[model samples]
Target: MSERENEDRKIPASDPVIRLTRYAQVPILAGLSVAMVLFLVTFFVDIYDAIQSFEFLDRKKTILLILNLLDMVFIANLVIMVATNTYNTFRLKALVQGDDYIQQGEKAYRRMKHRIVSTIIIISSIHVLSELLEFSQTTPLQVAALLGFHLVLLATYVVTNVFKSSD
Candidate 1:
């Protein structure tokens, strides 16, 4: 093998720079966990408020509240996915090494990207729905713009998946 290739294969786990980066990821993971908890708390608070106000009697208000809760769920799931994947990529790499690790990592990456996009689309749709529910307060232009943005996101997801499948 070439000298450069041999050097490239050497593990940098002992390197200070590598160690620092790995350590840095700890706080990031912690912050993500905190954020996920906060989202959960917010979700339950919304549910309690809805119950207290007897929003279920009003179909429109109930639907809006449900949509808001769904949006929070999607967002929390996104945050959890990111945190888990980040932990697996960084922390698991040193413990697991092989073709399987590389393959699994790649698959996880693709799935993560797909799910993130899907979550964003769902959240945006919820926002659009909530706005539509309050049509009296929403202008035609605002509705049109929101709808256009949602379509763009949906189209982008479809086109990316098409290309990914082709590959």
Candidate 2:
């Protein structure tokens, strides 16, 4: 064997700290997987519901369906980002080139923060749309609160993007 190869194999594969840290992420990955599966199940259920009620379809319902699907997509993206990034971050061997981009310290933190904020933006948008479509059942105070929440999310999204662009 080459000297370099032997040296590479010398890196400890049984370090207790590294093993603990890597396995610590197992629960997180499992949780995200469960959530992702639930989202997929909910997506299918939404499709089934729409099909079952095809004859009763209306404009508002159609819009809500689209928005709901979009929300699910964003949620799936967030779950995937967390699962993949966490694995790439802590695993002995990184998974992909994208993992290199998501390396440790400030860069990783910003990436995660941005992803979470973006997910929140999508969620808040979904809530706003739901409130708007069901306005008849929503009080003025409720509408105001929903709008306020959405605005805050929008502001965060904009600010984050602007600052991130500079970085």
Candidate 3:
């Protein structure tokens, strides 16, 4: 036994991945929580700015262009959802008490990372496709170069997740 457990202390059942997962959970959540609060604050401020622009009903350009508005909603929702998720993931008091909720939260946290990455990739692809459609003379070479880079990035992330995932 190691020095800390030399006296027959016990640890929860864990494999290398689960052990690393539990170990990795806290700092990641903590960092994400800090980010969440900052983004929520920013979102609120942006909303106020947007509202103020409504006061100028006669203006040519309103609060935000359509794409800008959509981007704000997407980012704000991401920040809020991730923030809540990180909190639930890192809050382990229920886990200590053997609560099912904590386990669910942990699972959700893991799943969310995969889901979020996939969502970003899909949305990015759509955005790029739209831009390509708008451009009258985008070259195959330029498009292929851009797409090749994204494909490499996507493959890398997928491989990393597969290697890291237990199931």
Candidate 4:
């Protein structure tokens, strides 16, 4: 190929779009870090409440604490995935092996989505279970709504997996 043709194919070293994309990760990282802190703080608070009141750590309270901790874990996982994936995506080609890095980014995205759906399903199930266990207080309508939400989440997870497998 001619030198000019090769030059045309190359991205400029000072390309604004690439620079901006890379720069954007700074704020994203900062924001997610703050959220991570809050998640951790709240998770600890839930644990403290459960343990400090050990005498009253009945099944309902125990389940709620466990659910809150699980939710926090899922949130933390999501934040980490977003932060790393964002950094990976905007990184300069010179810093990473080209096609392989890009493929890994795609795989990360797929895994993130699967985790998100699974997290929602688990959280939803916890909510439903809590409601069901409170047999005397939970209305039938509330029970139905919670069950429906959980079913939708399950369906979404299944359909997403099927499509991903097909690909």
Candidate 5:
């Protein structure tokens, strides 16, 4: 390749459109960070509530509270995963050149997808468990719906992993 061509390939952010799109991700990353913090705060507050309540001694109530906290953690982790991947995708390319950027971006994307699906499955399972703990208050239809949703998520995760392995 010509020297100019090589330089052009190395600096994709030189294009105004690419630069603008990358900069646009800044706000999204910021929003994700804020959401993660909120989730963390809520997680801690739930812990505090559990500690302060005599209901914590009750097996069902304690189990439910723990499941709720787990749900919050999974959500916070999802937010962190997205934000980190987004920043690395947009910012890292500008800092690194050549095939390394392409490979890293592709790998990061696949990893993010898997993590997101897995986290969703975990959150769904927690929800189902929590509902089951309060079975008296939960209608049979509600439980069935939650189970169906969890199964769908599980199926999706399996299909995605199958395709990924095939690739």
Candidate 6:
């Protein structure tokens, strides 16, 4: 063993990612948690539509379905957001070391990257599903444009965070 390996090791408080996250996690989680509450409210939005039914609404069925899909997206996004962000910002080493799937943190960032990618996927799925319903009368060109944006976001998030699957 090398003599240098015997020295005490310390991670500096100057690391920008660590320092920023220490202070930022609370506000970020608080805001996201509130957003989750709003999303939960959206889930129950269809009660009035349900009571009135076809008498008042022309396409109440379609609206209800879309709202349900939106609710699922929001819930999924919230779960991923809370899970991944908490793991990355606070319980980083514990997350990495405690998971059997983590391979001893050899690829320390891999777990984080994968979680981030999954979060992006959930968010993009929500956006697409919501757009499909609200933009029901949209032109083909507009739908295509929105789809292109989703694809770009998906690709960028995947490419940047995750190791190439093809590789």
Clashing pairs in 6: none
Prediction-by-prediction clash tally: 0, 0, 0, 0, 0, 0
Model 1 clashing residue pairs (backbone): none
lDDT: the better of candidates 1 and 2: 1
After superposing candidate 4, which stretches have Cα over 4 Å from the reference? 2-14, 92-104, 135-137, 165-167
Write one digit per residue (lDDT tens) for candidate 3, span 65-122.
3334455556655665676676665565335434455567667877777767665666
Tens-place lDDT digits, model 6, residues 28-130: 7777777777866666666555555653354755664665656567565656555565655455543332343245443545555666566666666666666
What lDDT score is found at residue 85 in candidate 3?
70
Task: Tell me how far the alpha carbon of residue 12 in candidate 5 is from the true structure, in angstroms, after superposition.
Answer: 4.5
TM-score for candidate 1, please give it. 0.84
Q: What is candidate 4's lDDT per residue for 123-162, written digit by digit as tens?
A: 6776787778776898899899889988988988888796
For candidate 1, which ten residues in a row score worst on lDDT? Answer: 6-15
Candidate 4 clash figure, as a count: 0
What is the per-residue lDDT of model 5 for residues 1-167, given as tens digits with 9 covering 90 to 100? 79999888766556688778899999988888787778778888888888887769999898898888888888888888888888888878777777888888888888899899999999999999999989999899999999999999999999889766643
lDDT of 5 at 25: 93
Query: What lDDT does the true structure give each of the candidates?
Result: 0.85, 0.78, 0.62, 0.74, 0.85, 0.60
Extract clashing residue pairs from model 5. none
Give me the runs in candidate 5 sitting further than 4 Å from their true place. Answer: 1-13
The positional error of residue 24 in candidate 1, measured at the CA in angstroms, is 1.0
Q: Is candidate 2 or candidate 3 better by TM-score?
A: 2
lDDT of 1: 0.85
Once fitted onto the true fold, the runs of candidate 2 whose alpha carbons sit more than 4 angstroms away are: 1-15, 92-105, 159-165
Work out the TM-score per prediction. Answer: 0.84, 0.74, 0.45, 0.76, 0.87, 0.56
Top candidate, metric TM-score: 5
Q: Could you tell me the lDDT of residue 42 within candidate 5?
A: 82
Off by over 4 Å in 3: 1-72, 93-106, 136-142, 157-166
The local lDDT score (0 to 100) that residue 23 gets in candidate 6 is 65
Model 1 over residues 19-68: C-alpha lDDT tens digits? 68977999999988888888888889999988998987899888888889
Q: For residues 46-145, what per-residue lDDT tens digits would candidate 2 score against the true structure?
A: 9899989892278878887888888888888888887887775665233332334335445776778888888888788887988888899999999999
